[model samples]
Target: MVRIAHIADTHLGFRQYNLDEREHDLYNIIDEIAEKILEERVDIVIHSGDLFDSPRPPAQAYYAFKRFLAKISGRVKFFSVLGDHDTPKRRGMPPQKLFDDEIRVLGLTGGDHQVLRLNGRDVLVAGVSHFSRRYREILVEELKKLDVIAASHQVSVIALHQAVDRFFPFEEVFELRLDDLPRNFKYYAMGHLHARTRASFGKGELAYSGSTEIMRSDEISDWEKHGKGFYVVDLSGDKLDVREVNLEGVRPQLEVRIKYDAFDLELKKLVEFLKTYSGRKSPIAHIIVEGKEVDRQRVQQSLNKALLGKVLYFRSRIIEEPEKEFIELKPGDINISALLKEYLRDEKVAEFGYELFKVLKEGDVEEAKKIADEYFRRMMKIDSEKGVS
Candidate 1:
């Protein structure tokens, strides 16, 4: 029997553009989650990928990761497969050993996948780390090679980082199809998609243990408020039981909507909203104000007081010119007058449309009414061949 903890996508050094103090706040939250793992006394910790937001994280991020490792050293064995973010050559060779050898971390790049004997049974741990985006599909090929070795009743688990088959729009990068994976493995532990999902494909259990921190807005809507956590896998012979371990002290996300014709009135209303809703320990706030010519600075400045004494992240956008031209249509710019021409001509608009739709929270409000109506109309017409109302 082997007890393993699976977590991924810490995304260290991620910049929090909206809030002044949000970056450090997220880092601290991750530390808390790691500490919880130590307290649980899991035998091994497996990070699927994306340890750093960049291939090279800033000094602060390095120190934070080091501190986290210090807390769990000797207590739990940590093994991780590098994601696209962990650049192997950028950091030089010696310090890389600090992650692999001294840290008791074992995975691809440091060592090839191997079979371990536990309780008189064999279990194979096969892994491949952060291949460059262009060549990440090598993972599928590597798995095929492993399938040549036949092991009867042995549980083979693959820790993979890349996206697969557009699990979500955001997860389309390392995109793979169900056919890409080998047919022999018993378990497939995956990352990069920030959702807890389970599926049976090719005689194996495919599971994704999402991120330990919530940094993206869409993660909230898609994950059903279940983004922050790790998974505990209890392995006994040929069967596996998985459970979620919630990290404590995470602030709940607050989506506040205040509408006014005047920007001044909107600012005043925002302050009042913050004052009434703010909490000391866990303050995750997303503020959206809709009006014409909204003074972004005034609203941000006024809410400063309300934001103090709490951990809050605020996002604001001004939609003053509602029907304003999104793009200029020129005679030379393809015939946008036609529906297909309009949709396919501007790929940028389509991408922007997806991004905007992800952030607009409320569906039953006047602010998002037009935006939602346009999105549904276009989507239905294109994908379903239904006319816009």
Candidate 2:
């Protein structure tokens, strides 16, 4: 049976919370991932995309991946597609090109497909680099051509670094919808959406193997439940079977919510929980403080004292309910933009703020960047018209 390993969104060099430890954790995971892939004895390895967190990754990120490739270079075949983060904003070569001799990176220069003969059978490994939402037509055109090529192949797998609307709920940033994909490939190895997801599509299944480590606080719950990992696909059977291989040694992250009235009691419980994570690398904590009329200053001081040595670092968010006057409002049509404008007293600024809020709420970092750029451009144009130096 032909075995293929699928992994994506490693985001190497991402230093979450400005911690150097977090940056190196991504590199460490790559080593762990290689060790496991070797143990499984897979014939092929597929890194769907986002091999590095940025197009111009740090030098240490290059060295980390170099060591990883050194371990698996000749033993197995490795293929990767350039992710949105890995695609340069200007004319430049992709970072993966430096390791061209060690691996094949698809869709950057031209041909994104490679037909391989493994275990006396033909297997097609094809993928395209990321395409922004505005340039989706170009991506679709490429996929249409790939579909024709995939028609004759029985064991075919297609990878992409773009987010699909169906799997990725952010409409503003999702580049493609479910129907945008071709119905020919037997396995769809997708990336961009950090959450692991799988659905039966076309003749086989579409799956996102997810990121190797927790990149954000919100991803903590999913990571705890699914445990970060990769997948192994068996193509020699009547229908392909996928097996998930969860990685160990990932740094733990924790979250705790405390009500204002029971702060002391809840703090005690939280401290006990933090005490249990006695590892070389301490866990990161997200503390949520909730209640009406919450004293933000007191809570911050208390948390600092309690968490100083327990966690590597801790960040907190305070949630306060609207004023009692707001609670008495009649049930009627609610307009969030109108309310925001009322509070800001400037229609233009309110609109800009609302747009930013929407993108941040959806966790669409690309869209947030776009909105911020548009906001600044408009401001600069207005300033110029007003003769503001």
Candidate 3:
């Protein structure tokens, strides 16, 4: 019987909310996973994609990965593909060279398939790196080629870091439909999306191991539902037996929404919820207020004082209803700067927007343009550095 560990979207070196401790948290979780691998004594580890948060990972990030491999490299074989975040902006330069040959990093520059002989049985592994809408045809062609090769193998698996039509709503124009995949493969291991999912495809099963940690506020709900973990697949039988091994010590996260009229009641409820939390550590809370003309500052200050040290981070998201009953329009009644400030708060870009509005309102067009450019550049840099997006 072949035991394989399927993991993906580790996103190592991700410093969430610009917190250094969060960076350490990522490394800690990886170490735990490595220990689990040793305990399980799996034959192979298949990391679908996203080994590092960025293509050009920081020194600490690289060292963390190296340490992880050192723990289990010789005991077990590891295979991975390049995720969108792991792809370099500069063309023709693949990041696979950074690792030793002990690990087989595929789908970087060209190659897409590898065959491993285990326990007198042949296992074929195929993959494709992140690509845009323009390369859908190329991706389809490659899958067909892999399908032909898989026909001769005992077990065939395909790893990918792309959105599949069955998993998510049809929002992305470049998403891969279920029909695009070849029917011959035994299993499809997926990544990129941060949610645990499993769907049947033709004669095989397609599953996403999901991100190991929470990377964004929107993922909080998904994490709460499925938890964060990797998959354990036993391919010895005719039907695959897949199970999830949830990693322990993941920081908890909570999302709360309160109407303006029920602020006091909701505040009390939140306090009760925190006081009763039985997790190993305090959770990060995202409190969202929804209503018209609510005093966001007053509520936020109250929450901060009440929940101080009780939660790791207390974030406030205030969404106010637009005023639509204005009898007449005044010159400054619809101040663009004021509107921008409110919008920025919702978007969580208040700091940049504040500086931008200051320069634009001062009538310095050149300075405003520079500020705008610098703001976007900084945002992109942050996104790239933390693998957010």
The model with the greatest lDDT is: 2
Worst 10 residues of 2 by lDDT: 323-332
Q: Each model's C-alpha lDDT? A: 0.63, 0.87, 0.79
* lDDT score, candidate 1: 0.63
Residue 63, model 2: lDDT of 96
| Residue pairs in candidate 1 whose N, alpha carbon or C atoms collide under 3 angstroms | 164-176, 165-176
Candidate 3 runs further than 4 Å off: 92-96, 277-279, 321-389
Q: How many residue pairs collide in each prediction? A: 2, 0, 0
Candidate 3: give the clashing pairs: none
Q: Tens digits of per-residue lDDT for model 3 on 236-302?
A: 8889889888988688888998888888998888888898666567788898887888997798788
Q: Which of the predicted structures, 1 or 3, would earn the higher TM-score when compared with the native?
A: 3
Q: Is candidate 1 or candidate 2 better by lDDT?
A: 2
Candidate 2: pairs in clash: none
TM-score of each: 0.70, 0.86, 0.80
- Model 2: per-residue Cα lDDT over 30-122, one tens digit each: 999999999999999999999998778899999999999999978899999998777875678889999998898988853379999999999
| Candidate 1: segments with Cα more than 4 A from true spot | 18-21, 88-96, 103-111, 150-153, 169-174, 222-224, 261-279, 282-284, 291-313, 321-389
